[model samples]
Every structure is written in structure tokens, then in C-alpha cells.
Target chain A: MKLTRYNPSTLTDFDSWFRQPFVGFPSAAQVFSDSGSNRLAADIQEDKDNYFAQFEVPGVKKEDLKVELNNQILTISAEKKQTAGDTEQTYSLSRAISVPDGVQGDAISAKLENGILTVTLPKAEHRKPKTIEIA
Target chain B: MTTNCCNPSPTQQTAEPEAAVMKPRYFVDGTQEAYEVRVELPGVPKEGVSINLEENVLTLRAKRTPSALSDWKTLHRELKGLDFLLRLRLNTQVDEEKMTAALDHGILTLKLPVKEAAKPRRIEVQ
Candidate 1:
């Protein structure tokens, strides 16, 4: 009897291939929602003075984008509408990130440019790092 | 020398580089007259995007603007510093000369008009 080699990598390859629909050709909705999660991907970075959060939100108008900060939680919500032929489609996506300490909530500012929403949270005056000189 | 049956060899594993080029997410829709393709290319300026059509295949490439905040500490990251490359094969004939493209809010929209001869026409009943 001939024996077959059990390769574990093949299982992972098959799993990823099955997750993406149509294999080589992906439709618009499939790529937009990301396997039906409907959650927007984001990146957060911090410097000595400020914390920056960037969100990828394509095909969304500025008026439809909303950013809210409450109780140390930053929430980003957006709505995208598309009309093709006789059908109309609307997709809503929202994601929240907990803010760290020492953030100036009232001074937070958000800007939408080139399909990216950057929310900048400045650190409070006392929260900034102080460079003490040697006496 | 001895080896486990389930453990794969170290040389067989290939690790993809973190900065490798990636295909940006896109959506395509079409009506009878034209097809609309929208590509999400965040952090890429209008001048960094290029579209080319050769034969029946359409190619789109976008280079993202490099981040200047390299000294900042990353708290969480989902975006990568990689360019976008996408190639699509068109089964239907398209009017290449009449095609139009627009970039707004980091999203690129391409409108490919269908060839007049290839458009579906309803035959009149006698």
C-alpha cells in the first residue's frame, strides 16, 4: 500500500483560499466588508506630545464621517452609499479604541484627507514629558 | 539523526517581508453602458496613482506617501508601508479612449465605457 505524506501547510493554504470568495476574482462587496466583518482597520501611534489614530475609510464622504470621544473611548463611524443601475447599496462601519491616560479630551481634533481619517489627541500640558537639566 | 514526522524543516518555511507590495482592496460594478471600478488607496496622492490598459487587461498601481513620523512609537498598526498593484482582466470590450478616472478622498474611481458595437441591443419585433 502506498503512503501519502501529510503536509500541514496544505491545510492552511486551503483554509485561506476558502476564506476568500471567487479565488482569483474578488467582487467589490467581498473586498469592502473583509469577510463580512464590516469593521474598518486602523493604526495608532504616539509621540511625546500627541497620540494619532488613523482609519482607512474609502468611498465615504466627509459629511458622512463622524468621530466622537466619550469616557476615554474614541469612536469612528462612517457611512458609504453607492448606486449602480437600479440597485442601491449602503455600508456602515464603526470601530472604537480606548484612549490612554493624560489625553486632553476637549483638545482632540480630527481630519479627513485622501480617504483617511486622522484623529489627533494632544496630551495635557502636565502629561508631556519634561526634560530636566542637571543641577 | 532523528526527525519528527509532523515538524516541518526550517528551510522549507518562507517568511514574507513586512514591506512587500500588496493589492489594495477594490470594488467593481457595471451597468450596460459602463463599468465603475473603485480602489481604496489610503495615503497615496493623486500623482502617485497610474492606470494602464494593455489588450484586455487593466493595471492599476499606486504608491503610498511614506510616513514622516518614523521616530514615533507605534501603539497599534494595521496599515503597512507597501505600494498597491492590481491587474484585472476584462472579458467585455471597453472603449479605452473614452475612459475617465477621478480621485477623491484617497479613493480612485475608474469609468470604462463599453464598446458601442459590443453593447447589447434589443431587436425590434416585426
Candidate 2:
């Protein structure tokens, strides 16, 4: 959706109008917007005693984030809002994943920093990854 | 996962690259006073981000720190350990000197403030 009437003519029609030497390739503006809900990229990392999930949730305020854990299920939701003039806009995104067995529900911790959200889930006392030496 | 994050920014930037640099997905929103540009750059550290504006062109580059997975198993592959690279042609209307940028939670935001002369002004009553 085009939110503004301002057209970036300089950015879009530079090579075509001015740069004659660069005739083959004119347009250089590569604009990408992933408004899809599934585009929220994430990664899962695990250690001996804990599982850590790191994901990109930028431009989302802390108060707009809603995270819930229930029955080994983890759900993350966020809403981003921007107000300009008389227009108020909102972008809502939600993603969920299932936690492995033996993770401590009470110990799950989440932190949103620098537009990145990191969630850590600790393994139960006896569920830690076992390391055994070969005989 | 789609863009290769190792190549350099293109002089005449295009939609696709030569599998050398990672072109992150981003969105640009503009207001009368400022234009907000947000790019997704997961795991990129503070020191890894670099932004340069020359003439009417802006280049954005960042390197992402790898995850903490010990003995990783490739059951699924989506997000890659990559570097972000993007080049954009800025209009003369953009005030580069007044531009500001910030990175938070894997997102990079660039605030391009409009020049006073470029901004629309309200006329006083006669």
C-alpha cells in the first residue's frame, strides 16, 4: 500500500534520465517489504542445559509484544504502530513453535533488545544433555 | 535465507546480486519531516553495521554473528549465517547530514530527516 503521494523520482529515474553511460541497467531501486506473517525469521540454538531462540522482531515496542507458553507450546505476538498526521497504522505478526519435552515452563525467559527478541528455556534438572566418555 | 550475504554492494544496485552479499528485506515509511527505513538483519552486532552516504547514494552493510548451537544438526535450514549488503540511490531531497540510524533487536532503522527547504510549509494569513 502506498502511504504517501511523494514520489522518489530521483531514486527511480536517475539512470534513465541522466546517466547515459549506464544505459543497459536504469532502475536501481530494489524495494522489499515482507508484510506476510510467516516472514518473521528466527533461529533456534541449544546447549547442554538450555535452548535459546533468537528472532527478528524489529520496530515492535515492548508493550506490544505478547508471549505465551502452554503445554510445551510457545507463541509470540507483536504489534507495531506508527502515527503520522491524522493517520495511525498498525502491523500485527504472530508465530508459534513447540518446545521439546523436559523444558522448565517457569524458567522460560524472554528479552527484547535492539529489535531482536531472545527467548531462553532451561532444561529440567534430569533432562540435561548427557555427555559420556567412551570406555 | 534467499539473499547471499557475502558479496559487496552494487554500484548500480539491482534486485538480485552475485551471491556475494546478503540483501536483507526492508521497508521504507515516510513522513513529512522524516523517512524511516527498517531492515531485518538478525544477529548482526553493534560493531558490524556500516552506513555510508555519498552524493545521492546510500550503502548499508552489516555482518551477522553466528548462532550458539554446539554440534548443530541440519534437520531444517532457513536462516543463514550471512552478511547484509544494500545500495540505494538517494534523492537530492534527502538531507544526509541530518540523517540518523539505529539498530535494535536485529533490526536496523535509518531516519532520514528532510531539509527545511524541501519540507512543505504552511502559508501565513494575509
Candidate 3:
């Protein structure tokens, strides 16, 4: 069976419809698409409370990294500089993720511990349930 | 005719298993004292990391330990549960004896000291 690579930026229903011919599982497709955005491989997971995204960023010091959020869009960018054989080489990777409507962008917090950068965006409000009384 | 027998193409090394997703991105920064090698290995803990240098070749391998939380379903799992492997051919200037490595935050940083002969030397003339 062929595996389809997943791109997280896809939120439209038509995107899933187009992917119907390729991968049967969504999680497997997401794993296969790690090669799309340069050397940055990140995972987004959901639980009862919040959504967490952990990105792989090695050799990037804290000062060279930047995280910005605007209107539910989170952008992670980092600049990697190295001096190889007396010649300076630089490379930068940036990824912008579109958060769902329920996420609280203002309450988002990020921390860099051990080389992985973890960004947590809490769910703003839970869906309210409605009930109709039977007479 | 020039013979390029010293460098071996990465594909020639067949000891790696088929399951491995080889050739991870790496950065080599050369300084006056030593060369720093950085490899991104997310989700790997400190215990399973290994770095070995032998016969002019440097090999890096890390095995992923299954987390005890099997009851949870994996959604959008990317970096976890995948083993890491990369075999890099090193130059002769690398001082194998003094090499050091550490794993933090899923990134492995290795310091390879340059041999004395390979370092730049200043000569005085009368």
C-alpha cells in the first residue's frame, strides 16, 4: 500500500477528499510528510485540555529562534549559522501553522528545553451543549 | 588520471537496516580548536543515545523506547518511535581519541578535536 504524505496546513474538506486516493490513515500520512518543510519536523497532538506542538530544532541557540502569533497563525522561525573551514554558512527554516478556531492564541506559551521547542495553545472555550425539554 | 578511492558514497554502506530512515540533516561547524557536529533527533531520551567512532568512520545510532502509555491513541505522531541511524565518514584530521558527545532535547552535539598535524602552525624565519 502506498502512503500519502500529510501537510498540516490543509484544513479544507476538499484536501481530504483529494487525499482519499493515497493514504488510508491520516496519522501515517502526517508521518510521511516530514520531508516537506526543510529540516523542520514537528508533531501536533490533541488531548482533553490543549494542543501541543513539538518541533525538532538542533544547533539553534535560543537567541536565534523566534515565535510569533497573529490572528491564530503561529510562526516558528530559526536561523542556523555555522563557520565551516573559515567560511560562514547560514540557513534558516520557518513554519507557519494555522490554529483551529477553538484555540486560545493569547494564552499560548512556548518553552525550549533540551533542543525541542514545545508550544502549548490551550483551548479557549468548550462547546456548549443544548437540550430541549419534552412536554 | 585521478583516483577518488578515499571517499565512499553513503549508499555503499549496506549494514543499515531497511527500516531506518537514514541520512539525517547535520551541521558541521569548524572552529580553530575543534569541529562541532549537530544532529536533530527529536523525542529520543538520554538513555538510548549512542555515538561510536571506529576505523575512520563515525556511526550514530539511537533506539526509541516505547512509552508505557499504550492506552492513548497516537494522533499526528511524527518524531517519536522512529529509530535514528547515520554513518558518517570522517576525515583523517579528526582526533578520534578526544571526541565527546551529548544528547539534550533530542539533539546530539558532538565535539571532534582536530589532530595537531592538521592544525595551522606559524613558522619563524631567521
Candidate 4:
């Protein structure tokens, strides 16, 4: 199945549609205006087994990146000090993702290249069915 | 690109220092199958959002309905200003009819499915 892009501003059926409730009214300033250089983009890849998350977090040091796991949920957060862009201003961006059940937490790993941060979460073994004799 | 239909034009609102103003951020990504565009517009409710396609241009505009609820004693104003704009141009191969948008969690995602003629296909043996 293909997932369509979500545009909140252009939604015509918001009143008639039922959702899980928004995590506060997210605004452009809340996400983009924070202390430190912000995460410019994120790429989430999910297959039959596991999910991989990659983020473009430039000008951030390796130690600044933080990852937390709680009850099958994973939240990746980071903070970068202000650079040339806004020396007088500070900004931060945080994203939390819920991991599916039966996945190993310690096996997750992250790597930074240039300014991109990539995290790979391996899926737990999937169960397959087998037939048994009726005798 | 400014069409003066609304009471307070967003572009002008962003220029003023009355309240908190926002800046538009564009996300452009390419995968093996297609390219995705994610533009972030926060604070504005879904009712005030509009996306239009004319010629090769794709325009996005979202604003906030200035609220009347104000607490004089408890208010610490951080500039909750309105007016946001996101605009783009599509290539000739993009399928305009299949374009989709959803406002989830606060992120505006636009999924422009590629035309069948533009996708890569493999020929099988007869």
C-alpha cells in the first residue's frame, strides 16, 4: 500500500474526520525555532520486518545526539549550539517514534555522515506457520 | 503571489514585530521509486489551509483565525503571529490528479505520485 503526503492546512474534511488527536497544535515555530541547529529532514523506511530512520542534522556533534527507549517506544532527540546562522538565537528540534513490539532495543544503531544521522532498528524474528500430521 | 482576499495579508503579518512569526522550511527527498516534498507549517488550523495548482506552480497557504480569548493577567506573549506560505513548481511528468495532502501531528506532507509513464518498468519474458 502507498501512503499519501499529509498537508494539514489544505485538509477540507477536518471537522468530519476522526483522528487520534494532535500532539498539541503543532506550529512552524515550535518545530523550526529552537536552540541549536535544527534537524532539516528525516527519512523513515519500513519494510515487512523493521524500520529505519535517517535524519539530516547538520552541524551537530556526535555527543549531542540522544536516543531513548521506553516500553517499545523510541525517541531520538538532539541539541546543537547556535552557529553562524543565528548567533544570538537558540533553537532545538525533537522527534519521538513508537517502535513496534518484539524488537530489540540494544541492537539499534546510529551513524552520522556530514550532517545526516541514520538509525537502523532491526526487527524481531517473524513467526511462520507449519502444517502438522492429523494421525 | 500575494492575492489580497483575506483581512490581514500573511506576508505583511510576517514582516511586523507584533507577535511570534514563523519561517517556512522545505524538505526535498528522492527515493528509488519517487521524490517527496514535506513543508512544515505549524500553529495554523486545518480550516485555513489552501493548496492550489495553476500551470506548473503548486502553492500552499495557511493562516490562523485570530482568537478573541485573551487573559490579561496570565498572558506572556511570545508572538503567536499568523500567515504562512509554501509554493513549488511541478515537473511535466508529475500526476496532478494523484497528488495527496494530510496534516498529521503538525507536519504538512504532500505526496505527488509519479505518472505511470514516468515510472521505470521492467519487461518480462513472453
Could you give candidate 3's per-residue lDDT for residues B18-102 as a string of tens digits? 5755455666666656778777765567787888777767777776554323433334555654677777776646787898998
Task: After superposing candidate 4 on the true structure, give the runs of residues whose Cα lies further than 4 Å from its correct spot.
Answer: A1-35, A38-135, B1-23, B66-80, B120-126
lDDT of 4: 0.52
lDDT of 4 by residue, A50-115 (tens): 456656454456787787776555556777554221243445656554455556688888876444
Give the alpha-carbon lDDT of every model. 0.72, 0.65, 0.64, 0.52
Each prediction's total of clashing residue pairs, residues at least 3 apart in sequence or on different chains, is 3, 12, 2, 20
Which is the winner by TM-score between candidate 2 and candidate 3?
Answer: 2
The alpha-carbon lDDT assigned to residue A26 of candidate 1 equals: 34
Chain A TM-score for each of the predictions: 0.70, 0.65, 0.65, 0.58
Report the C-alpha lDDT of model 1 over B1-118, residue by residue, as the tens digit.
1111111223223454544667787777777788888788887889999998876778777888764378777766767757887777777788999999999877898998889997
Candidate 2 lDDT tens digits, A4-103? 3434674332122222211232221111123454444556666676767766676677899888986555767888765443578898776555566678
Extract clashing residue pairs from model 1.
A114-B105, A114-B106, A115-B105
Worst 10 contiguous positions by lDDT, candidate 4 chain A: A14-23
Question: Candidate 3's residue-wise lDDT over A32-51, tens digit each?
Answer: 34465554555665455666
The CAPRI-style docking tier of model 4 reads incorrect
Instruction: List, in the given order, the native-contact fraction of each candidate.
Output: 0.82, 0.28, 0.48, 0.00
lDDT of 4 at B77: 24
Candidate number with the higher DockQ (1 or 2):
1
